[model samples]
Structures are given as structure tokens and as C-alpha cells.
Target: MEVKKKLLDIVRDTVRFKHYSLSTERTYIHWIKHYIFFHNKKHPKEMGKEEIEEYLTSLAIKNKVASSTQNQAFSALLFLYKEVLGVDMSEWNIQALRAQERKRIPVVLTKDEVKLVIENLKGIYNLITMLMYGCGLRMNEVINLRVKDIDLGFDKVYVWDSKSLKDRVIPLPLKLKQRIAVQLEAVSELHAKDIKDGFGAVYLPYALEKKYKNAQFETKWQYLFPAANISTDPRTKIKRRHHILANTLGRNIKVAAQKANLNKRVTSHIFRHSYATHLLQAGIDLRSIQELLGHKSVETTMIYTHVISEMNKAKLISPLDF
Candidate 1:
């Protein structure tokens, strides 16, 4: 079989199985293409374990790709052989040189610094950052938030299909509830316009679109932070509203951070780090914080313990102590 045809078939099979996101499919295909091209367009099936090993070694020794990038390539190839090609890759061994692990702590903005950053941001950008710190949400989580996910009356925000496909709820600040209510009204108006323009479909995950054909058109299914303009869906080619772009938010965050004169290197994740540290300072349990952050492991949450310990170490001792 031609390599391109075989590759397309593999991607189709992966998509049919609904294993992961469309983004994953595109990335896997791109890496596989590069692998094939690197070997002068030789068919992957004609290559064996020795060829795979050489390719991975070249990534480390010649290409000098980072450990994570090499790992992603490994995963993509593994999926191709095992899931797509119907061959087990368990017996194959190809190791890239592992990168050194760094112990650098996450940059955390002080509460006052956070306040300054928020104050510098205007309009919707300010609201988004407030939610990031207030709820300890990742930037993607904030962007993907839907009207149905927020429980204003209960003062909670539900995060669904988070990293690792897990769902968790975090407390919503009461002060933000009124602001969110106002935002929802604006969302409703925008939704109405989309409906009027005959573009009332929502983006659903895989086969869910078929199962719930009209679900996307509903108010509850609307994105809480819809993009400023309606755009055609790349996959379905249907006109629909998607969430705000990460780059747009990222640029706004950089400007806000600079205006605040914060010395720390601040980004969206910094708000999340600050949120966890603040919670630790306020005596929140590690496990509880882990749940709120949707962390799969308790060890991931333990990073904040060092922040609390350092704060404790800074206490002033009595001058006349015996």
C-alpha cells in the first residue's frame, strides 16, 4: 500500500475509535510524516525495530529534541504500530536520552501583585484572570467554561472533561457571582444573534454530535466566553462559536503583568500557583486542594507545601528569648 494512503487509513481508524482529540490526530499524523520523510519516504511497515531505534537515537543525538518532544514522538509511533497497524510494539525498545529534571519552583505572584495585575486588566480580560486565581483554573479550563458549568446559586464552578478526562468542581467566589450573572446576560444576547443568523450549532465531542443533534443550539450549551466573532468550524465546516483564543488571552496577560510592574515572570499558570499557595496559607488540606485543581496525584499538590514551609520559616523570633 502507498504510504500516504496507509497513513490516512491509520488516522481514520484512530478517529473512528474516538481515542482522543482531533488535535492529537493532527499531531500524530505530522510526526509520522516527519518520521517517514527522515527515512527518505520508506514505508514504515518495511522498517523494523532496528530502524525505529536509529530514528529515535537520531532525535536525541542529531536533532537534539527535548525529552518531552522525543517522548511525544515515541507515543505517536507506539499508537501508530499498536492501535493503527495492529502490531504490538511491546517487544520493541528504542530509548532517547532523558533530560535532567529541574527542581525550580513555580513562579507565584503575591496577593497584592495579583490585585495589581487584575486592576490593570480591563473588561472581560479582568474577569477571566479573576476567575483563574479565584477558582484556581487552568487557562484552557477557563476558556472552555460553559453556561451550564457554572452554578451561581450554589457558588460553585464545575470543570468537565479536564486534563485526564476527569471532572471536578471548585468554589465560586460570591463577589464574582454578580459579575458572572451580568456576563451571562451578555452571552444570552450574543447567542440570540447567532440563532437569528442561522448559526445555532455548538461543537460537541465526537459522536455526541450525532446523538444530540440539537443540543449545541441550546442556551445551556453556549460557551460562557465565546469568541468575539462567529467562525466556521474547521472539522464540520459549520458556522459556530468557539471559545476565546489562548493567544489573545496570553497577550492581554503579558500587557497586564507589565503594567502592574510585577518582578516575577507572570503568566496564566502563575495565577494557578498563587491560588494553590494562598489556599495552603489559609490552612486548606492538600487533598482538598488537589481535588479543586483536578490533579491526578497528591504528590503534584505537595509542591505547595514548600511555599507554606518557607513562610513559616520567615516568622520573627522574640529578641529577649531565653
Candidate 2:
């Protein structure tokens, strides 16, 4: 009989089997290891609900972990006990720190400040910043763009399998047509060079690799923002250029914000906030903005209303006028 896999290996197999994202898998494993180590390397199978509570309380009291981090640990443990270990944890009273509810308005850029920020960014970075502001793409949405996902004729960009595993359509800005074509040509050259080096396959999501034998080699599925160099895939050991990391955009935007001398905190997400607020300023209905922003509820999109036009202005009537 084959020996049963170790705890971490079993968790890995379970996460992959459920098609969780790579980041999520890493996070779950990290928390599981921490839980075990906190209890002096005790196996999870030997522990029960009380041990889980003690570990979580230690995090809040000793480590002083943020409410969000505490909750993440809770969720990771919940998944481990319920899903992986086949334990019934629903009856366990989890007394972890609750995440504080925050209601701060999102930061929005004026039209001209956006123009200044865009002007400071050059080449591919500029195009990406434009998409963030112009089309309301999340940072991951832009980085993971495949060549086949864009349609210039219809002026739309298809954002696929994004956060919450929901896909939506974003309108392509007219100004970006020529710029995107140039970008495509540059990417084509890079791809050709990669092919020459016997390394041109890109990662596919949800078993597309099994569905289409040559999907990896097809340029249609290639990352629009291919990385500067190829690297070995952790799962398949194939060398392919993944999309440029999202941190590159954050770092470049910081520099650009400094160069523009803007006094507000600026990040790639600011562009997305600006996208929603600007639309609201132009009298776009909440429902339309909700759909464009790909928010599951109109309430999430309504936050922009608090930041735009008359909603933000102070107009107190004078007693003398009365």
C-alpha cells in the first residue's frame, strides 16, 4: 500500500483539486504551518476546536495581528478543518478579532491631474495606466490580458476570470487603438524571439492545457504584457514568460505621482476609483457604472456618489438671506 502524503502535501493536492488561485493556496499552507508550529508541531488530526481557538486568541493578543489578518487565519483554519480534514467545525464558537468596518471615501483624481499622471508615464506603463483609468480594470485584470481578449473593431476589452471568478466587458478607449496596435507588434517580436529559444508557452487557466494540445504555443492565449524573461513554471516545469508583475505598475505610478507633484496618495487603484467617480460626475446612472465596474452589487458602485459633484460640496445657506 502507498504511504499517505504528508499534511502540507495533502493540503496542496486539495487546494489544486478545488481550483483555488495560486496566492490562496500559498496563504492557506502558510497559515496551516503556523497553526501546527504554534502548537509545537502537533498534527491537525490530533487537535480539535479548542486548540484552534487558543491559536487564534494568541494571534490577537501576542502577535497583535490586524483584524483582517486575523480573519484570514480564521478562514484558512476553517477550510483546513471542514474541507480538508472532514471535521464538522460549524459548532465551534470562533472568538477571533472582528475586522473594523471602514467607511472612508475613495480617492479620486480630477480630469487634469489624471492627464498629468498619464503624461508622466511612458510606453507600456502609460497604456496600462490609461486602461486602469479609461476602462476601470483592476491591476490583475490588465496584467493577465491575453491577445485574443481584445477587440479593436468593437472597441471592447474582455476581462476574464477576475476576482470572485467573474468576468465582465470594459469599453476600450478610442485613444488607445493606435497605441495598442504598436504594443501588439512589440509583443509579437518578443514572442518570435522566445519561440526561437524553444520557450514560448504561456500558462492557461482551468485545464485549457489539456483541452487544447497546442494552446501553450498559440499567440492568441499569450500574455499581452509578457515578462522581460522566461521562468520555470512551478507546476509543469515549463519555461514561459508570464505577464509582467503588477508591482511594476505600482512602483512606476509612485514615481510618476512624485514627478507630477500631486499632493494626494496615488496608486494604480486610484485610477479605477477615478474611472467610477468620473462617470458619476458625467451623470452616468449607478446601475450602468455598477455593471462597468463589475461590482456584484449597486451598493458597492454607489460609493462613488459620495465623492462626486454636489455630494461632496458644502452649500450652507446664510441666515441673512432668510
CA shift of 193, model 2, Å: 2.7
Best by lDDT: 2
lDDT of 1 by residue, 1-322 (tens): 6445667565656865764766787878888888888899988878867777778778878888777777778778887777777877777766545444456667788899999999999999999999999999999999889989999888999999898678998999887999999999999999998899888677866577778888888989888899998898766587888989888998999999999887778889999999999998888899999999999999988989987777777685777873
lDDT of 2 by residue, 188-217 (tens): 888888889888888988777889979888
TM-score of 1: 0.89
Report the poorest 10 consecutive residues by lDDT, candidate 2: 94-103
Candidate with the greatest TM-score versus the true structure: 2
Model 1 segments beyond 4 Å from truth?
Answer: 1-9, 12-19, 309-322
Off by over 4 Å in 2: 1-3, 93-95, 309-311, 314-322
Candidate 1 global lDDT: 0.84
